[model samples]
Target: MTLQTVRSDILAGTVVFLVALPLSLGIAQACGLPPFVGLLTGVVGGIVVTIFSPSRFAVSGPAAGLVTVVAGAMESLGSFSLLLSALVLAGALQLLAGFLRAGRWICLVPGSVIQGMMAAIGLLLILQQTPVALDTDGDSVTKIISPDSVLVALGALLILALWQTRFIKRSRFLGRIPGALMAVLWGSLMVLTNDYLVPGSLADLDRLSLPEIDSFSEVAAQFSHPEFSAFWRNGAVWLTAVTLALVASLETLLSQEALQKLCPQQPQPSADKELLAQGVGNMLSGCLGGLPITAVIVRSSVNVNAGARSKFSVLLHGLLLFCCGLFFETLLNTIPLASLAAILMYTGYRLAHPELFLRQWRLGAVQFIPFIVTASAIVLTGMLTGLALGMLSQLLCSTCASHRSAIQLSSYSNHFVIRFNQNLTFLHNARLRDLLAKIPDNSVVIAEYESAEYMDRDIWLTLAAFSEAAAARGIMLERWPRAEDPQLVDGGVH
Candidate 1:
């Protein structure tokens, strides 16, 4: 690469690194795992995933959307090592799916359903983090109330909100700095200030906890390994594996699609290749005792906006995360937990914003119903169950709509012509039979299939049976392009 390209990559890489650091820790905490594991996942996403993925700007890491799945799996499995085993299997499933070229099918998932899933995840984050933000560590409200913690969270949140304003965004220098990094810095600075001034006053405030490793040499002790025995012994492990594979693969494909839109100048990446890259990253991360990984839109967006022109930026960011875990654990532990909670709460708000709901509602019932149902189900039940219910609801709505508009009946006196307006399938067979039986006796009817895109054998059989009975009822039924004509293809309409 040219010198200019190298310089651009370095700058972009630094920006992405800054954005990923605090978020990674927060995501791990949200999943009830060690803060270091989240950073490890980011490292794998940046280095390993970047090496294998085809997209130039795609950035991989732990995503907020998977928080529910990861938390539930952790609880059900009852051990981090057990969860790692499931994660490894999830990665293997993704690898198999990639080899099978299943990535393309992700496009068939409705946009509404995807949005609903995100909104639900966002709502969950808000609910889950509110107590943390408030620093409510005790059962009683009086004992749980910690003014110092609440102040820190609110101050960090205010800083984040102000950073997103048009005035700050228009500033050339401030706009380039990620708001998340700034929030973390603000929290750290507050802790330092309190320690130097009135340390005993804020002693009750909780801070991030990490092992007291003095040097890079001791960092290896933090690495974890999966319990291989859990793979076969616990059926829940397999269920968790399936859930992770499906969700991670879907999120990765969706991120790739979004990246394509953001960087239309860049050639589209192979979807299957993207899946393979993600699979490998998760497998490696699991082996090292890290959380599951996926192509995350937040980091990728930061990478692109910061002028990343190659995967070098992503790789560089990963290296930075590795170094952070080794040398910066002491400084990292000084960050207050309330600050991270605020950051996560803000992220959740963005996902389940009022505007997102209003936008879906404006799209009409067909889209809004599924979107709301998916979000509600996910919040009330769980991710997989909610998605299944949402898909079923969408299918029912789409089928009803198709049945209403799929055919048209036009009657000119006793001469009735039935025109197929859309594709015919088994689902339409019953409706077709009902319409045919309504035709009056001694009537002349015409069966038209020229407009239909596709016709199933069941539909054709229904038509043939109607034609047979038409003659007995003195109703003459004729085909548009005679049945013997070459244009009348079998099982398909042209």
Candidate 2:
């Protein structure tokens, strides 16, 4: 690559790291883990996954989707140490899934369900961040607006405004700024100046809660290991691990697909390789007292949009997180929780944007209904519940919209013209046979399948049986020519 490309990637990497810094902390807090655990996972994901990831531009880190599950698991499982057992198990399952070649089945999942999951996650982010944004201390999913969080959220929102909108962004001077970092900087500046000017007025406000570390000994004290003893009898833990594996894999696959869509020229990523990478990441993170990691779309998009040329940018971002954790923990801790909440809130907005819903609607009810159901179920019930309902809708509607008979037959006075869709398989064999059976005795049948890319062996065998029946009934079948043999269309008659 050119030196200019390297420079661009580096610049993009720096910006992504800046965005990641506060988010890791925020997601960790939401998941009931130590703040550093989030950073630890982010760092591990960057350093470990880059070696194996097939996506050239996608970034990996702790995801927001698992927050509710992880937190609930922690509450029911009794301890963070015990939670690690589930994380490790989830990683192992992911590794096994990759080896088993389950990655290719990702396409079998309906698009509406994926969109619904994204929308639900977006809503979840906004709900979870509301408390932190307002400086309130309990769950805010039900209570979205808190009186206390108003000022803090508004201040952070203003920072987002300056960085995102025309007021400051329209100016060439401010266009280059990263809005998330600015929000953090502005919040910290307020905290710093408030302490100096008013002394005690803002002292009670919630700030970034991190380990008070001055030495290696203090840092080492925070390290934890998974509870190996409980692994054999913990049925609930196994369920949690399985849930984590499924959700993490689904989200990673979705992100990888989205990344491919954004960078269509880049090589398509292998789902199996990504699963393996994540497996390795989670295994290590669990052992080292960190949260589970997955492919994070927000950071990945930032990396790509910032002109990143390769995975080197992702590697560098991880290195930055590690180095910053080691040497600049104090500076990092000075960041306000409210600022991080704003960033997440913005990220959530991107995921559940109204435009996404509108686009799904334009795709028609077959798509929109499942999307809406998934979003509503996740919001009203939970993630898994929402996904179940969405998948049901997808399967029920798929017959008319997605999976359909490939062959179309047009009848003439004495003959019939048969047209085959690009993909012909066993799924279309039944329909094709029914159409063929309707042909009258002594009819001239035009069997055209020149466009069929893949005709299954079963389909061919079935057609052969039908052609024998047609021959006994005195019907003559005409062959259509293509690059491949016409046997599939001519019913093995060559």
TM-score of each: 0.87, 0.77
Instruction: Give the per-residue lDDT of model 2 (tens digit) for 304-346.
Output: 8788998889999999998877777777766667777877787
Estimate candidate 2's alpha-carbon lDDT, on a 0 to 1 scale.
Answer: 0.80
What is the Cα-based TM-score of model 1? 0.87
lDDT of 1 at 335: 91
Cα lDDT of model 1 by residue, 75-132, tens digit = 8889999899999999999999999999989978988989999999899998888788
lDDT of each: 0.88, 0.80
Q: How many Å off is the CA of 174 in candidate 1? A: 1.0
Model 1 residue 214 distance off true place after TM-score fit, in angstroms:
3.3
Question: Mind sharing the TM-score for model 2?
Answer: 0.77
Index of the highest-TM-score prediction: 1
**Clashing pairs for predicted structure model 1, backbone only:** none
